[model samples]
Target: MSDHAVSGVPGGPVRESRDVADLMRWFGDAWVLPLLVGGTSLVIGILLIVWPNVTVTAVAVLFGVYLLIYGVFRLIESFAADEAGGTARVLLALLGVLSIVVGVLCLRNILQTVVLLALLLGLFWLVGGIIQVVAAILQRSRPHRGLTMVSGVLAVLAGVVVLSYPGISLLVLTVFLGIWLVVYGVLMILGAFRLRAAGRRSVEVTGGAAAAPAG
Candidate 1:
């Protein structure tokens, strides 16, 4: 007998089936915004690298505003969780406080934060691309090797692109990021409906079977 038959569970969660497609489209769609963010950060880093004197004031203002909003959201989320006695409530509260502190520190040292983030993102892409390349190479003998290799190449290319052009503006990156998130959100909603449809079909089939037995 099938697992579904044994368990009598009509359908699996919608998230699992649609997660891959949704995430892919999301990332693909939001590519521009992330690029913009990276570009902006790169520009800021370059400015700081060239003109350290102006870095302090620019960073201080930008970091302060970012942290203030982030901290507020974190604190509210933590407080709500704590009130509900959710698991890790205390941890959430602590994290909220920590984020607030970090935000304050960022305000004080915004230039440094931007530099660090840029470096980290660049390094991450390089490393991730390398890993994908290795995986694809290892799978070269497999049936789907061509597809896998292409994917790996694309990943590597994207990483290289980011590394090559790190001075794009943040606004553009934000927009790109927004596009992908919206795509994923829509996909997720669609997946839920698909799951519902599957469920209805299953029920109709089962009802037909039961009624036939009675007849």
Candidate 2:
């Protein structure tokens, strides 16, 4: 429900930007982190909003895939969270495990999996938002710290709302899920570009791109 890049390659910045998802590496291909997560989230969000009639099985599969991708990236992000030190890294790692667990929960009947997700999504987002806030706090001087913190707060609010209304109708839940993914994806994509720019700046000054952000 919530999450948070740079590129290294030949060609002008124009061509380089297209390497948005060349690989999932965090340091050299730092851009991959957000782009992959953001791109997938955006696609899922669009599907949920525009294709409400889509089969539950299809949505469940896609959701599972998203969780797997998110888990992998988050696990790596935990390692890259240098500024936040060990505590933040550990929390991110645990969150990654949780994501993976839910993804693997796909083995259950499709309907059951979907219902479980609907119920668990709030807790997932709540924990993720808390981790984000903590990471931002630790890296007090990071660019956009205030905005990041605010977004984390928003995530917490969204989680609380969803949790408070567990019996929210399917249509309402779908809309909620769609809107959440869209906003989260847009923020991640924007952050990716910011990272790309920062990487360019680093390359100019120190002959290398900036490292990935802390989780």
Candidate 3:
């Protein structure tokens, strides 16, 4: 009999189904997934950069789509057993939900959503820069502390500029967003390779253990 039939015969279907679900959950942990996601982001960033004159609505829609994809990626990452803990998973889920909500809102209202997103981005940068500055100060003895402080100051200045000029031209905003996306995509791609290396090491260790003769 087929495996499905065999599973059905002994009430093994539940166990089989659970196994399938577990497999599906772990599938996203593969390195290729992040690489694919990063490639998609890179393409979107390139398109935005090349066609900076695209309509405002188009830009908004593109951002919405990107945010949706990012949210899904975050959700998948949260499910990786080897990565996030319970608290991290919860935070990632919340962040995913927020991204989805913001994306949907952007799709519904282009102009307003763009402005609001810019404001939110500015606020986030401001807070992040402040945190970085504090961390750098605490690590003042580090060789790169001055560089970190400079970066934090630049981030804070960028945030202030964006906040002060909330009505910046769409082209400028697109350029900034495109650059950010490209950088983020590159980072994600690098991270994917790192994860792949880690997975390989884990497999090697597991294989070595399995092959060892036990007492």
lDDT of 3 at 97: 65
The TM-score of predicted model 1 comes to: 0.30
Model 1 misplaced stretches (Cα beyond 4 Å): 1-164
Clash pairs detected, candidate 2: 5-31, 6-30, 6-31
Tell me the tens digit of each residue's lDDT in model 1 across 1-215. Answer: 75445433433333333443444344334333323333443444344444444433464454344435534543554453322344334434444455466556555544454334333334433554454345445432223234434543554564465567566444433332233223323333343344345445545554444344211
- Candidates 2 and 3 compared: the better one by lDDT is 2
Where is model 3 poorest over a 10-residue stretch in terms of lDDT?
139-148
- Listed per model in order, the count of residue pairs whose N, CA or C atoms clash below 3 Å is 9, 3, 0
After superposing candidate 2 on the true structure, give the runs of residues whose Cα lies further than 4 Å from its correct spot.
1-28, 110-115, 141-150, 208-215
Assess each prediction's global lDDT (C-alpha) against the native.
0.42, 0.68, 0.64
By lDDT rank, best first, the candidates go 2, 3, 1
Q: Write the per-residue lDDT of candidate 2 for residues 1-215, one digit (tens) a residue.
A: 22211222346442443443232123435766878898998999898899776555666667678888888987987787676678777877886887787776643464554456566677777877887788668755344456557767877888898888877666677778778888877777776676666555545543233233334
* Candidate 3 lDDT tens digits, 18-95: 554445434425778778877887888899899898777787788778778877875765565333346555555655
* lDDT of candidate 2 at residue 161, scale 0 to 100: 87
